[model samples]
Target: MRVHVHPDRCIGAGLCVMSAPAVFDQNDDSGLVVLLDDSPAGADADHARKIAEHICPSKAIRITGG
Candidate 1:
């Protein structure tokens, strides 16, 4: 799957990082969402990414092509 994060829309909620640390992270300085793995492998990772996308308060995460 392909994942994308819109940093401009991020609100530093850190939900993505909490939900999918392997695929996402938060910048310590700016508190913005950081893309760790744009293309996460395996079903478990993909599921975690999806949870991140859904839980993001700012809806800054996007996933395409599962």
Candidate 2:
């Protein structure tokens, strides 16, 4: 699946990072969401990405072509 995070809408809640560290991260200075892996592979990564997208308070995470 393809995952994307909107930096402008991120609230720095860290839910995405906590859910999927391999796929998501935060900026050190701004603490906004960062896209570590836009196209994550495997079932586990896909599940984690879905969790991160669901838990994002600002809905900053988006998944496409899943």
Candidate 3:
């Protein structure tokens, strides 16, 4: 799936990073959501979706076509 993170909407809660570290991260400077992988494959893709649809408290993570 294609993962997108909106840093502007991030609250620095870090749920995305904790849920899917391979696809998301927290900026060291801003503590905002930092997308580590825009496109994930296999199980990583599913994991990204979970973070986007459920885990992200700020709704900073979004997923598109797989």
**Number of clashes recorded per candidate:** 0, 0, 0
Candidate 3 lDDT over residue span 1-66, tens digit each: 678777888999988777778888888998998887898887778778865548778787789895
How many pairs of residues in model 3 come into backbone collision?
0
Largest lDDT belongs to which candidate? Answer: 1
Cα deviation at 34, candidate 3, in Å, is 0.6
Considering summed lDDT, which 10 consecutive residues are worst modelled in model 2?
Answer: 41-50
lDDT (10s digit) by residue, model 2, range 1-66: 788778999999998888888888889999999888888888647665658888899999888885
Per-residue CA lDDT of model 1 for 1-66, tens digit only, reads 789899999999888887888888889899999998888888646665659888989989988885
Estimated TM-score per prediction?
A: 0.89, 0.89, 0.88
- Winner of 1 and 3 under lDDT: 1
Clashing pairs in 3: none
RMSD of each: 1.4, 1.3, 1.2
Instruction: State candidate 1's TM-score.
Output: 0.89
> lDDT scores for all predictions?
0.85, 0.84, 0.80
Query: Which residue runs of candidate 1 sit more than 4 Å off their true CA positions?
Result: none
Show the colliding residue pairs in model 2.
none
Ranking by lDDT: 1, 2, 3
